[model samples]
Each structure stands twice: as C-alpha cells, then as structure tokens.
Target: MDRRLRSILKELIQAKKALTSKFIANINQVTPRTTQEDIKKLNQQLLSHGASIQSIKGRGYHLHIEDEQLFRHFLTTALYENKDQKQIPNTPDQRVRYIIQKLLLTMDYLKLEDLADEMYISKATIQNDMKLVREHLSNFYLDIRVKPNYGIRIIGEEMKIRFCMAEYLIQRGSDSNGNIYDGFIRLPKEQTDFIKQTIIAHLEKQHMTLSDIAIQNLFIHIAIAVLRIQNGHPVDNDANPKQEITHTKEYKVAEKIVGDTEQELGVIFPPTETSYVALHLLGTKILTTADIEKNQDIESLLDPAIYELVIAILDRIELEMHLNIRHDRDLMINLGLHLKPAMNRYKYGMNIRNPMLESIKKNYQLAFQAAVHAGVVIEKYTEVTIDENEIAYLALHIGAAMERQKLKQGPKRCLIVCASGMGTSQLIYYRLKTKFNGKMDIAGTTEYYRLSTYPLDDIDFIITTIPIHEDLGIPVVEVNAIISKDDLQHISSYIAGTPSNVIRDFLQEDYLFLNQSFHAKEDVLAFMVSEIESDDLKRARFLESIYEREKIAPTAFGNLVAIPHPLTPQSQQTFISIATLTEPIPWTTERTVQFVLLLSVKKNSVEDLQPLYEMISKLIEHPESLQKLMQMTDKASFMSMMETLERL
Candidate 1:
C-alpha cells in the first residue's frame, strides 16, 4: 500500500464515527472517480491482510481491523526492542520496505491505491516496491500477495514475522538488544572475566536472572564509563568522567526521577557514571553532527537502584504468580487508566462516593450551558454514550455543595450553656469548636440560669444541653450530648453564617419552656416520610437504633462536621433528617451536633444507604439553604426550597 493512502485510512479509524460519502469525496475532491476506484482497491487490499472493510450501502467505507490483540502482540515484539539498536543507513527503497513491514505489524489491511497515495508513488512504483519487499523478506517466507481488484495481503510464519519486525525496528534506529553495545569497547580481559563470573554465580539458582539484552546494556553502560575516563575527562571517585557539565531542565528531570527511584529502591547510583554512559550513546559526538537531545531523555532517568528493584520485582512476580507486566507504554498506560481512581480513593481515606466529591465533580450541565452560550457546537465523532460513573460523580458534587451551604450560616461568637458547671460546659465548648473551627469565637460556657444576669453583649448565639425557661435574649439550641459528625458539620455550617437573630425576635418569655421540644420531628419527619418511601423511613429508623447504642463515642470528625449514623442494621426503612440550629449545642465532648440527620436504614442494603448518605451529606453543606428550610412553614415551600438547593 502507498504511504499517503495508509495515512488517510488510519485517520478515518481514529475518527470513531461513520464517514459520509461527501466526506470521502472531499478527501479526494480533485478526482472523484479515481478516488472511488482507489477506495475499492484499498478494500480489497485490506481483506488480503487479514482485515476487512465495512461499507455502508449509502454511506462511506470504514476499516474493520481483525485480531486486534494479535496485532498488538506482533507490534510489541516486532517493531520495538527492549534496548537501543543502531541506526541503519540505506536507500529510499529500503526505507519504503521498512515502512511497509511496520505497517503490516499494525495488522490493519489497507487499499492498494491508498497505500500508493501514502507513498506518493504511482501504481507501477508500488508494484516495484512489493518486488523489493518480497526479494529481501523471501527467506522469512512472508508473502506480499496482490488481489488486483481486491487489494494486497502479507502472510507468513508469526515468528518470522516478528523477526522481520525486529529487523525493521533496528534499522529505524529503535532501541533493541542487537546494537545496545555498538559504541562500547570491551573491558580489560580480567575485568570482563570477573563480570561474567559474577553474573553467572548470581544466576545459578535462577535461569532467567537477567535477559541477554539486559546484560548487554549493562556492559555498554560500564564500557562507556570506562571510555570516558580513559579519554582524559576528569575522573570522579567512582571512575566516571566529569566534564563541563551544565544542568539543563532535562537533566533536572533526570535528577528528580533518579532521587525518587533511589529512595524507593534503597540503593545509591552515582550520577557521574550514568551521565558518561548517556553521553557516549546519545551525546552529539557519537550519532549526530550537531548536539541535540532525542527520545532517550526518559531512559536516562533510570537510576541503577530503581532499575534493579524493578527487575527484582518483575522476577518475583514471574516466579510466584507467573504474571508478566509488560513495560511498554501502551500496556502501562491502559493499566494506569484503570488503577488510578482506586489508588486515589485508598490514599485519601475516603469512601467510593465521598461527601467532598462534589467539590471536584465535573458539571456537565453547566458545561453544556457554557458551550451553547459561546455558540460552540460539539462535533462528537463517537456515539454519545451515557457514563454511569460520570453521573455518580456529578451527584457527589451536588451533595457536597448542599452540605457546604449549611455550614456557611453561623455567627462568629457563641455562648455554650449547661446545668453542670465545667463538665458539661467544657464538653459543649469542645464540641462547638470542633464543628465551627476557625469560624466560631466561643464566648464561654455557663449555666442556663445565669443567662438573664450574665452580660449578652457579644454573644451571637447560645447553645444549651438542657432546656432553659427564661428568654435569654439570644437564640438557644437545645441538643443531646451524644451527636454524630454529620449533625455537627451541619450545625457548624449554620453557625458560620450571619442569619438574623431569630432567638431574640421570636422567643417570648411566656413561650420559653424548660423542657421545650428538644427535637422538632413532627413536621420535618412528616416531610421526609412524604418524599421518601415507607420502606426507606423504616430502614432509617432501624439504623437509628444502632446509632443510639454506638453513641458511646461521638461521631464529630472535625471540619465542623458530624456523621449521625446507626452502628448496625435494624430498620425496615431509612430517612435522613437534617437540622441546623441557630446556635450549635454540645452533642459530645469530642464533637458538636447542631445539624442532626437521623438515618433510618432498611433491608441493610448498602446500595440504598449509599444514595441516602450521598444526598444528606450534600444537603448539609448549605447554611442559607438549611436556614431557609428551617423557616419554611408548608411542605410545598420546603420542597421548593430543597429543589432550589439541589439546583445550587
């Protein structure tokens, strides 16, 4: 196939969508009939190469690559090498032959005309090209067959195919074992014998202690270091040559990677020695007329310690599990693309769906909005498939924002009141601080009876463990000592905001009750039960019983947050109740609970609990939203407020 035509087909494959006949027409706009003929020819060629072309009756053609995994296997072994290879100098015909060989390794069949166009030659020229490919590659018994009207095909022994590939890669200046030691001279006879003896002794117990290629690369490195020292360069203590070395950015990258590798592997690799070897192989004097860094910058970053550690790890895996992790970029990238999220969750000590996930969630709706506003239309090449994971991510973000708004509503100064002097008072103080953190300036702890007598000049809010009878000229939030981290975070969120002093305005001395409703459940609970199913509520109530027992330790996990959860499953239904206090009350000594969510879980289903927790955690974040919610009198209004909060 011609080089130009091959490039065109490859581009189409990457496009990921169907091509219109018009699109193909545009590609060969100058000569429509000729291009049509070319397309037919390319299709035939593809079939011969163990691949096929899918042509929509009305639409255009698409390449259907077969045996993709086999193709990758072939490419890895055939086109690439584990180490460096010499750059082959040859004629253009040789280069063309090399290109054809490498392309075949892709295992993607191409049309003859397309191949001809890629090579920028005529059909006759392609025929000649094929003759040369056959003449040289004949010993490998690789057949390059042309099916005139169909296309062309190359067939042969898979092993020989790989050998041809290795040859092509070496000729193309690829790093392979064959030429790894090209520039390095042999060590002194005694030194050489000693090195071999040492390697043999080390490998006696393991037949594959080191690959033939690895040993050769190691020798090259050592030999290059020796040559640099012998050539009158300043010799370091380690017998490495040191010249007028300047640390460029690339070298800095090398230094950083080397340091990381050394720490991880626990071995010291002298920079001077590595630098000499690198310079000998890739330096300006050896391979090029002018000095320039090439592809091997990454290779130079390999410290001996890290390299050896990697080898050792690979060796163990092969021995113990019989699993080989290909060190190639494509394989590693594919693996990493899958493993990164798992690793991130593990390191951060977060659940799969973390409450804080909202902060980092991608707002696709917002993105679409922006795109439309900017008059930009997305030209999707592939089918627009919905990603469930992405939806979950967005949901997490929304949940986090809801939780944040709850924390943003509290005032700076708050006074903690309780019947007990320092014991309960101190617990209240600590809990408030845990929730509000830098946001709250706790006035002090005092008895509720002291409120009228005590100066209330700077107290923005008052929190009490026990209910008070007299109007204290401040908003008083009564709470139980045992509170969850979720509730505390919600309360801290409210205390952080500058909501109106409803305590001073709404509380009447006559309305004050010592044992006034500590928890207002009539309306809010009704609202939850109305919105959520009966089963959900029952599950939530069951979960709450477990939480009651586990109240032995407060769930105040700092950041002005508390997670009120049942320790075990006992409920038939689950519902979350969110409460934001005007002032944060003492839930416990370890944390405070101003915002309380009673989780009633049913069926002990982890799946059901995930969504409930996700939603509650997200909702507790908004201070203004919670305050608005608290002020709502009707169910409809509250639901509307929730909807608005969800929009946020």
Candidate 2:
C-alpha cells in the first residue's frame, strides 16, 4: 500500500463515522479526485484482508470490516512491520524517501526497473523522484552514482552517509501518531533494542546525561557503524585517530558500550569506530548539574562565554522585540544549559532534531519569532546558521519566559452602553461578566445618550448595542440588543484585545495582490517590492535584507505559505504585503510556495505582534482557509473569510 493509502486506512479505522473525500484530500494535500482514486486502490488491497473502503454516495467513504481477526492481523503485521513486499510507494515524496532508505540500507546498487517494480510504480515516476533524491543528498555532500550494467548506489563519505542515515532512519522511528514506519532502522528489531538499552545502561552507570533525541542519534551512529563493519566496509583509521580520544571520559564509556555489544553479538569494533562513538558522546553530552538548586548563581556555574551568549540574546530580544524577558534568570539558566550541548552539536556538524518544530512555530509564534532573532545573534556570535529545529528548541525556553512575562500584563478595560434602558445595560454587563470572568475589566454601564460623560481616555473599548459612527480614539463593538451565543463567540475574538485587531491593523487591500503570474521566488519578490515602492521601504536595502534572511534559513513554512521578512527593520511602519501566486513555485528545495507574505517591522517600534504571527501560522496549516485565501480575487471575499473564521 502507498503511504497515503496507509494514512487513509489509518484514518478510516479510527473514525467513528464516514469521512468525505474532500476532507481526506485536504488532510493529504491532494485533490478530491486523487483521494477517490486512492480510496479505490485501498479498497482492493483491504478486501482480501477482510476489510474494504465502501463509498456511500452523497455521504463519503466508510470502512467495513468483515473479519475482525484478519483485519487486525493485517493492521498489526503489514502496516507497522517491515513487510517490504506488501508496502509500496505511490506518492512522489514517498518514492523519494523509499529510494534513499533502500540505498542506505543495502549500501549497494540495484537496477532501476527492479526498484520501480518493488515500488509498484512506473520507471518514469522513479526517474522523476531521483531528481529530488539527488538534490536532497547534495545538502550532505552525498550523491548517487550509476554505472553501465551496474545499478545506482549512494556514494559519499562514511560520515556524511551516517548523517544522512540518522536523519532518514532513526529520527523517524515513529511518526507523530506513534505509527511506526516499516523498519525505520536497517538492523533487526531485537538488535536495535539491545543497542538502545546498552547505551542507556552505560550512560546511567556513568552518570552522563543525554536527551532522548541525542540518545537516538548516538544509537543510529553505533547501529550504522556495526552494520558497515559487518558488511566489510571498514572506514580504516581504527588505530590512527584513536590516540586523541583514548584518555577522555567519554572514550571510557564508549569503550564499555562497544565492548558489551561486541561480546554479546560475537563481533569486534574497530578502534576508530570506538573513537567515533566518543565524538558523538561529546557532541550530545549535557551537564548532570541541571537538577541542582535554582538558588545557586547560574553565571558562576556556566562558562563565561555561555553566560554572555544567554544574556546577550535576552538583551537583544528586549531591545528589538520589546519583550520584557531579559531579567528572567530561569530563562537565562535553561537557555545557557541548552546552548552548551547545542553549540557542541554545531561544532561537530551534527544535526539536532526537534520533533516539536511545527507545533512550536504554530502555537508559540511570538516566542518562535524571538528565537529567530536570537538565532541571528547566535549566528553572528557562533558563526553557525541556526536551523528551524534548533530555533524550535530555543523557543521552548523563550515561550516559558513569555508566559511568566504575562503576569505583568493586565486585563482590557471595557465599558458597556445600552440604548434600550438601564435594565438592558445591566443585563448586557452581567452577561459579559459571566463570559469574560476577569478577561476584561468592565468599568461601568451607561445609557447611550450619556456615554460622553464617562472618561474615554482610559477605556480600551466600548461594547454597545447602539451604533457609534464617530471614532472615539478606541475600538467599539456594536452587538445586537439580545446578544446570542453566536454573538458572544464573534465578540470573543476581539473583546479583550487578545487577538489585538491583527487583521485590521496590518493588512491593507492596497498591499494585497491576487493570482499573480510568477514562476520563481525572485520574480515574485521583485514584483511585490515593485508594487509597493515607497520611501518607507528603502527598496534596495529591503530586498537585500530579505534575501539575506532567506539565505540564513528557508522561509517556506509549508502548506504553500512563505513568509519573507527583512533581516532588520527597514521601514518606519510595521506593514505586511501579501501576494498569492497563480501557480505554486519551488521556494526551497524541500518546499513549494503559492502564498507569499512579505512582512516588515518598523524600526525601533515596540508592538505586540504575537497574535499576528499566531494567526498567520494557523492560516498556513489550515488548508480550507489557505485555499480560500489563495482563490480570493477581491477584498470582500477575504474579509468574509476572516469574519466566518472569527465565528468558528
């Protein structure tokens, strides 16, 4: 079964009711027609397994299991195990991953046609996927070599190959739903488990600390080394480079780990491989003193440079982002601790995977943005580009500080006005009191005619039943006299200024361009920059800064959304210029983008932009809203979508 088909089957098995093809298509980022065809193919595979996907017209597809035992066996054995013959690749991305993993596992060549046959895909589809595979490998300085009469094999340095394997194999042992991929590691399940437990036991015995992710990475390096050595692909230098690491603390533990695994498995590890293992240990090791009392001065415990990095990062965040977290001592300590191992990983050119990257980017937008700035500062200080995975890790510490900073934030002060009478005003006031419950501080109630008597400067907003056309230097939400539940829900989005008029504040129709015909990233950016030519933007510097930012990290946030921002504040006003492409273009090697959001922050301006980033992140993940946004040709439809979304 194709991975997408596996995904469909997984969803159907778990769902209590039938699901629409459109719904499934949205989830898989495919068309309804494609989803329907996949469902048909899935039904054929499931029928013999005692379950079939049955389509009900006007309703959707439903899973019907005729024999529970057979279906359970199929689900348990085929879906979750490395049943190579039963699993096939259909999607382009799936095929690319499959081809890479196969080459990495076999470490030898196989014919193209055989690979296509194994995948149950066309020779042409495999060829197309190879282009992407080659590009992906190049990032690690690896390549695929094909010779006459001999099949293609991945050709690269052993270290780079191991790095690639770590990314593709061990890191993806199970997906977010805990659904294990078929043979995520090349070794036998028992051997894999043995290696993991061995590493853990030795680390615990030595009182050395490693995060689960770091442990998994170390496990992959060991597993790869074992597999390579058994295949007679010895990297040599078993004794040549072993001298430097012979006396280290990590070397001792690595020796014990390798010795035990060798003893149990009846094999021997090369001296160089043992030293290599120690290097990984050095790259991933964390301080065991994290559990020490917080009252102990952190600066005294940390290296002076590590202390300087943390304080500098916090100070930069406060000065540039206006977040009051520089004084957070706990944040400083935690950040300092994380950066120590993180810097070592960078020094060793080792990858640190953050499984929570997307969630942090989406839910902790303000913190994520702060982390991006911190990443920039770190790049200047440490001379390493902090990737999204690393930034996500930093965001966790910043996010906690943002929560602590919230203690100083007070509630919005709102005043209620009723045109009907005092009875209606009191009723509206009490209703808000029940719904908000300290979310807002309602000063008092008043009749509409006498609303001018109350001081206007202090009030954040006025909740009124009567229409107030004049601008009173603050927002006014005019709700119906009989406030319905729907009304309250609509009011909830804007009431306490938590959402903070994000849409109305930043988005202007003049800055929006719909269905633009651009084929490349540069063309789209140049066109948007040209359309919004202004003295405030400082066009040349703005474009240069945007490109610089892109070079630091790919701006594509996935699901067709790409946010391009300047390296530093380039304008006097914070503004967003949005452009939707007629067709999606490859914005980065790994991602294509159709929706482009060009954002600029004002120089030296202090504004809370948390809601803006959060809403944008939510919109990026929401296919329905993103689809509408891309399709919208007029401002009315765009506003309508926001209004409808506000209600939801």
Candidate 3:
C-alpha cells in the first residue's frame, strides 16, 4: 500500500469513533472526493487481509476486523515490505525532508543534480526542495550556501550543526515489532550499548530516576557528542562558561560517565563536554519520592525563588482554571525541583529536547494549556522565552498532579430517598450501584418520611424517586421508583451537569460574534475586547494582558481553535466572548485558528471555571463540531448546535 493509504488506515485504527470523510480529507490535505476514492482502493487491498472499511451513510467510515491474527500478520508483512522496498521521494514535503536529512548527515557539499537524480525529479524541483530545506534549517540557526565551483553546503556554528544533526540527520529507529530503538546515531551497537550501560550504572549509583525516553535522549546526545568530537568538531568552550555548573553534583557524575566512556572508546572529552552532559543530567532527572528526606521541609530543599514561583503558578492556575490542585504538596515539590534546573538551562540558553512532547500535547491538552500558564510565569521571572518542548515537560508534571487529584477524590457521595417501601428502594439501590460502580459511593437509602430525620451532612447530593418541595442544602435529582435509562441519564445530568448550562449562562447572544472577518490575532482580540461592555481602563488592561500572555506562548491549541485570555482576570464579571472568523487566521506559525474563544474571569472571583474550560476543550477535540460552528451563519443555530453537541 502507498503512504497515503497507510496514513488513512492508521487514522482509522487510532480513532475512537468513526472518522468522517471530511475529517480524513483534512488530515490528508485533500478533498473529500479524493479521500473517498482512496478509501475504496484501500478497501480493495484489505480484502486479501482480514479487515474492511464500512461506510455509514451521512456519518463516516468505520474499520471492521474479521480476523485479528490475519490483520496483524498483514500489517507486519506490509510494513516489512515497505521497509525493504526503498523508493525515491514521491511528494514535495517528503522530498524536502529527504533533502534536509541528506544535507545534515554529510559534511561535504551536495550537488543539486545528484539530489535530483537520486529522487528521480527535475533540477527545478530539487531547487524548490532546497528552498524548503533552507527554511527548515533556518529554525536551527543553520544556513545553506552554494560555492561557485562546489555544490551546496550547510554552514553554521558547530554546536548548532550538532543540534541540527541530532534533530534531523539520524532516523528515528524502530524494530520489527514496532518498538522504537534508542540507538539512532551511526555508532556501532556495542559502543552505543557501552555508553548506555555506563550512564545507567552511574545514574543508579546516584539514585536518579530518569524516564526511559529521557535516558534515550541523554544516550543520543552523548553518542552524537562522541561522534562529533572524534571528527574534530568539539563544542566551543566559550559558549557558556557558568562556573557554578562545575560545582554541582551532576557535573561530577557526568565527569565520571564521560571519563569511563573516554577510557573505553579511546576518545578524550574536554571539560566543556562534561558540563554539556551534566546539563542534560540536570534537566532530565525525574525526582522520586525518596529524594526528599524524612521530616525535611520541601521549601528548604528547593530554591526559595523557585518554590515561591511554583506556589504563585499554582495559585494562578487554581484562580483561572480552578483545577483544585493547589494543595497537592507533591506537585509543588516536583515543580520547584524541575524549575531549579530549568531556570539554570534558561539562564545559559541551553535546549532540552523532549521526545514525548507531541504525545503529551495530543493526550494532555488541558494540562498542556495549564503548563503554558505556568510557562508565562516562568518567562516573567526569568525573562526568557520557553519553547513548546519545555512547556510540554512542565505539562507532564502538572498532568501527573491532575491525575493524582482524580485518584484521590474517591467518588461522589449521594443518598437515595425513595418514597416506595424498602423492597423497591433496595431494587433501585442495587441498580444504581451496579450501573455507577466505582464512580459513585452510595450513602445508603431512606424513605421520604424518614429523610427528615436522616443525616445529610456527609452526602453531596440527594437522589429521590418523587419530588420533595423542601429546602435542602444539597441538589436533589428526581427519578422513577424503578430506575430507567432516562432516569439514569437525568441523574448523570445532575451529577456531571451538562457544560452547555454553563456555556449558555456565560455566553450571551450579544457577546457571540460569528463569521467575523479578521486577518490577524491582534485584530480579533481588539474586536472581541471592544464588544465587551467594560470600562476603558479595564478593557485596555485586559487587551494588554492578552498580548502579554501571547508573548509567553500563543494560545492556539491547534485543531483550528484558539482560546485567548488574559494572564489574570480583568473584568468585574466572568464571561466568554467567542468570535468565529470567516477565514482561519494565523495564531501561530503551526496553527491557523478559525474559532477564537476569549475568556475573562471576574476580578477577585472564587467561582469554579473548570466546567467552562472543560467545555472549551471538548469543543476543541471535535473538529466536526468546529466545522459546524464555523458554518453557522446565525447565533440561534450555533447555540442550538452547541446544546445538542454538549449532550452528545
């Protein structure tokens, strides 16, 4: 099968629900008609395998498996066949990446004609690909220049060239079983193994717990450094001469690791090389609970400024996102510990490569956004711009805390007040218990007459069979004596509370701006701010805060969505003003945002906005809904669709 077919199959396999033709087309950057044809051809190929694509009229296409073993075998064989059958680049983007990788791997000048011949493309096509190659290399601060007699060569600082090689030259290796191999540099397997084992032994001795991906990243860095040094390209000593790094314990550890490798591999590394490895150690070490000594104060162990900064970040996150993770002491310590070395990296302009950045962004978007907020705080204090990779690492710390909070929250406690006799109440109780399972904790049952004498102090809400018109301090959900699916849904609605309720309450018709023609993010923000009925000073401050947040990181969350908000609350009342552009506007280099949700919280407000943010995140996840919202010409249709979507 072709690359596009494989891409479609992968998308179908990974999708949680059936993927629409439009969604698949968007992903493949093609028209729906073209995608449909591709799907038809893919289905033809799958007939020999054990899977087929089922098209649902007016819905989408779903992948059906007839035999799992056969399907798995087919996938393996197909992948192996593709691997063995090396072919030239067939697309412009692929050709660009190919040229970039080729140029980065070789030190000598590469002839344009040679590249054209290798890819079986014309010289003009090769020239166009080189233009893209230069554009991509510019991001790494590398330049591609052509000599009069010689061909094109990549010229840059040695360290930058190494960084580019680390990013582009080596292939992201994987095994036959689809396992990713860490040895990417062109070193012998035994040598790579020796370096990895050396680092592992020393890390174990120091009781440091770096993640697998972190270990692999460190291994790759050291391997590349060794290869580059052997080729007479040592890192410049004057790049960053922070004497404090030499005094740190990680520096000593790095020295020992490099010393052992140098003896084994017969290559000598300078003091700067040791410091470079130590910087990696400092940035990637995962803090275990054992790191904190018993009865030792965390604040005393961490830098005072970082500790305070972490606290401030948590406070701001709680105030804005209302994640309820401010009291997570473990999170505070982790963030503080991470910030110490991260601050060092930022101070010296060191880059820490995060291999799991893409996965983290896709899987933990809400947490990533919260981390972006944290990054803003870091930028304010450190006066350094934090990249997405660093922001993603911070997100991991915050995501873990959010997960811990979920595991610690137990379940919702509710009391069942059935008007029927004990027998019927018992039936209802068993049904709810079986349905909700671990999601709910039953606080026992009681009859309506006995409810007045029952203790309601420990209950979060009351589930009753019949309506009781009495004032209670908790929410009461009414259902039938025998719980039906609709009754359970009603209880669920009461329990989770459809985010549409919050959206409807906060998103007023006057505040909603649909199909607005704005070319830039600033224009969109200014228009949205003007629409808000607030004082001039507060409006100006709010606009300034939006720009300040943008400087730290753009608010574009991808999927054609951008949620722009101030760093802090700037209004007397919290509200969300939404503006959907007629055409997608550039919010960032990688993201063109069509839907902009401008959020402003009430000043000094303690209200929980988690549901509001959750709703926005949910909307971001559904591209179909975004497309539908963008197509809506009137507010009524948009509101109706939003309400329907919230229930789904």
TM-score ranking of the models = 2, 3, 1
Reference-based lDDT, each prediction: 0.42, 0.77, 0.77
TM-score of 3: 0.74
Model 1 per-residue lDDT tens digits across residues 444-540: 8777667678788777666677877665545566666555665465465446342222222222222221211233333333343344334434645
Candidate 3: residue pairs that collide: none
Preferred candidate (lDDT higher): 1 or 2: 2
lDDT of 2 by residue, 1-648 (tens): 557887888778755557777666644657889999999998888889999888878567889999999999999865665543445565566677788888988889888999998888788878888999998898778999998798999997776787787677654544322222345454666777788889999999988888776776677777777777887766657324568668989889999999999987767888878877887676355545544474487788677998999988988888877787988877887898788867766765667667677777667867877888899889989998778889888999999988987776788788988888878888888898999987888999888778777888778778889899775656687788888886687578665334535667777888889889998999999888888857666788889999987876677886678889886788877888889886778887666788898998887765656667766766665655566677679876786675455433
For candidate 3, write residues 190-258 as lDDT tens digits: 787788899999999987777665677677778888888888888888885537678888888999999
RMSD of model 3, in Å? 6.8
Please identify which of the two predictions, 1 or 3, would achieve the higher lDDT against the true structure: 3
Model 2 spans with C-alpha error above 4 angstroms: 7-35, 39-86, 120-125, 171-185, 235-245, 283-295, 408-497
Q: TM-score for all predictions?
A: 0.20, 0.78, 0.74
